[model samples]
Target: MIRRANPADEATIRDCAEQAYRRYVPIIGRKPAPMVVDFAAQIKAGHVHVAVDGDTFQGFIVFFPKGDHMLLENVAVLPSAAGRGIGRSLIGFCEEQARRGGFTAVRLYTNEKMVENLTLYPRLGYAEVARRTEHGFSRVYFEKIIGGPGA
Candidate 1:
């Protein structure tokens, strides 16, 4: 099940992100953005959601409203839980949240070196909107219009 993350879940969320993103550190030559987030602050601000199986955390997604749209800031799955559709489900949850909140679209960006996401986002109906270098990383931005024409 997926639900809003509580302050108590912060450690598990960080652990999951670390395990999920550790592999990319070497490939990208540095820690990915998600690895350095302040989970406690995010949870207190009501922006973090976690995917759980019983008492075990499988993954998490973080997002927040941005004007008329939503920004999907992070999606991470525990290494052991990869390939179980957790990432897709978390994204679906974000879209649902955006639609329910009357947002027009969901936007997200991934590092250019993260080839898996470059392919997966398009397959999930997100269109690449732009590419740019930001915060010392090459980032690719994507958006998906929800609850609208061509959504």
Candidate 2:
């Protein structure tokens, strides 16, 4: 089950992020990046959501409202839950939220080294809008226009 995340889930979200991102870091060759946002800060910003399986918190996604678009911040699923569709569910949640807010599109960025998402996003209807080198990494930016509530 996926639900809105609150400050109380900060530690769990952070732990999940540490494990998932540690695995990702090796492939990208980057130092560890924090998985969870500053709990208090994001809760105030209201952009964090959590994915739970019974009592286990499996993953989380964060996106920020930017004018008419939603900016995907981060989405992390524990390595143990990687193939169970948790990541997809979290993304669906984001889309639902965007549609409800009447957002025109959802935008996000991923490094070229992350082959899984490079393939997954396009397959899921995301289109590459731009590519560039930033912070020593080759980043691909994507956007999916959400065509209203029924779309």
Candidate 3:
């Protein structure tokens, strides 16, 4: 199940993000952007949602509205829970949110060094929209229109 994360889940959410993104540190020559987020603030602002399996935390997705689209800020699955579709489910949740909120699309960006996302986003229907250096991180931006034609 996926539910809005509260202050209490901040620690576990941070841990999951650390474990999921730590390997990318060396590839980027520094910590990924998600690593330094203030989870407590995000939760308090009602932006984080967690994926749970009964009593265990599996993953989490952070998203927010940006004009006509939903910005998918971050998503991470615990290393031990990889390949169980938790990450995908979390993303599905984000997409559902966009649909319900009357948003036209879902947008996200990942580090250029994160090759997995470079391929995965396209397979999931997102198209590359931009690329640039921001806050010292080279990012690849993608957007998936919520509905129309093949959508």
Candidate 4:
């Protein structure tokens, strides 16, 4: 099940992000941005969602609304829980949220070094929109048009 995250979920969220992103440190030469996010603030802003199996959290996704679309700021799945479709479910939740909000699309960015995501997003119907460096990190941006054009 997927649900909005609460303040009490902060630690689990942080732990999940750390475990999920730790492997990328060697690949990217630094911890990924999602590893350092403020979960409390994100929960307070109502932007965090967790995919849970009973009481255990399997993954999470955080997003911010941006007028015509929503920004998918983070998506992390516990390494132990990988290959279980949790990450894809969280993304589907984001699409549901966007459609309910009357947004046209969902936008997201991944570090250039996360090769898995570069391939996965496209298969999920997200088109690469741009690539740039910001805050010293090379980023690739993507957008998935939801519902229909100009939705």
Candidate 5:
């Protein structure tokens, strides 16, 4: 089941974050730089959403409202659950909510080493608008116009 995450799912989200990003931390050369927000903080800030399969949390996506766009903070699916379209479904949900809320677009950033998402987002209609250095990693920024061409 995919739905808005409540504060009660903090622990599950934290575990998911740790397991998903542990390998990438070394590549990015930072302990906590790549992931500044932990599960507890994300829940408290009300930015975390999750995907559950029979009470087991399989994936999550976090985001925050910014100006006329929604900033996707992070999106992850467990290794065991990765090829099942969970990540794609999560992004679709985000886009639906963004458009429903009257947001013009949805934006997100990913590191260069995360090549899969670099390809995935673009293939899903997210256009790479810029790249920059942040917290010691090269970040690729992308945006997808939601309502239409002028959106």
Candidate 6:
């Protein structure tokens, strides 16, 4: 199941992100953005959700609606829980929520050093929109149009 994350889930959520993104720290030469995210602030804004199995938190996705699309800010899953479809489910949750909010698309950005995401996002139907160095990190941006043109 997936539901809005509350204050109680903050620790689990941060742990999950830390574990998931830890491998990339060496690759990126620093902790990735997700590692330093302020979950307390995110939760306070109601922009976080967690995927659960029974009583366990499997993963989380953070997002918010933008003018033309939902910005999928971050997504992380327990590496031990990989292949359980938690990541995709969280993304689907975000997309469905965006559709309900009348957004025509979803946008997301990731570090270019994360090769897995480059292939994964395209396989999931998100097309590359741009790539640039931002905040000293080489970032790749992607977007998926979920609604008709000119919505």
> Compared with the true structure, what per-residue lDDT tens digits does model 2 show for residues 9-82?
88878888788777668787774334434766875577788998898888989898887798987898988888
List pairs with backbone clashes in candidate 2. Answer: none
Cα lDDT of model 4 by residue, 25-53, tens digit:
99999889999877899999999999999
Candidates in order have lDDT scores of 0.93, 0.83, 0.93, 0.92, 0.81, 0.93
TM-score for all predictions? 0.96, 0.88, 0.96, 0.95, 0.89, 0.96
lDDT string, candidate 6, 1-151, tens digits: 9999999999999999999999999999999999998999999999999999999889999999888789999999999899988899999888888888888899999999999999999999899999999888999999998884334
TM-score of 1: 0.96
Which tens-of-lDDT digit does each residue in 27-126 have in candidate 1?
9999999999889999999999999999988999999999889999999999899899999999999998898888889999999999999999999999
The regions of model 1 sitting more than 4 angstroms off are 148-151
Q: How accurate is candidate 3 locally (lDDT)?
A: 0.93
lDDT of 5 by residue, 7-40 (tens): 7887677677777888887776764342567667
What is model 1's C-alpha RMSD? 1.8
What shift in Å separates residue 130 of candidate 6 from its native position after superposition? 0.4
lDDT of 4: 0.92
Clash totals in order: 0, 0, 0, 0, 0, 0
Worst 10 residues of 4 by lDDT: 142-151
Winner on TM-score between 2 and 4 is: 4
Model 6 CA lDDT for position 97: 88
Question: lDDT, candidate 4, residue 110?
Answer: 98
Give the Cα error of residue 44 in candidate 2, in Å: 3.5
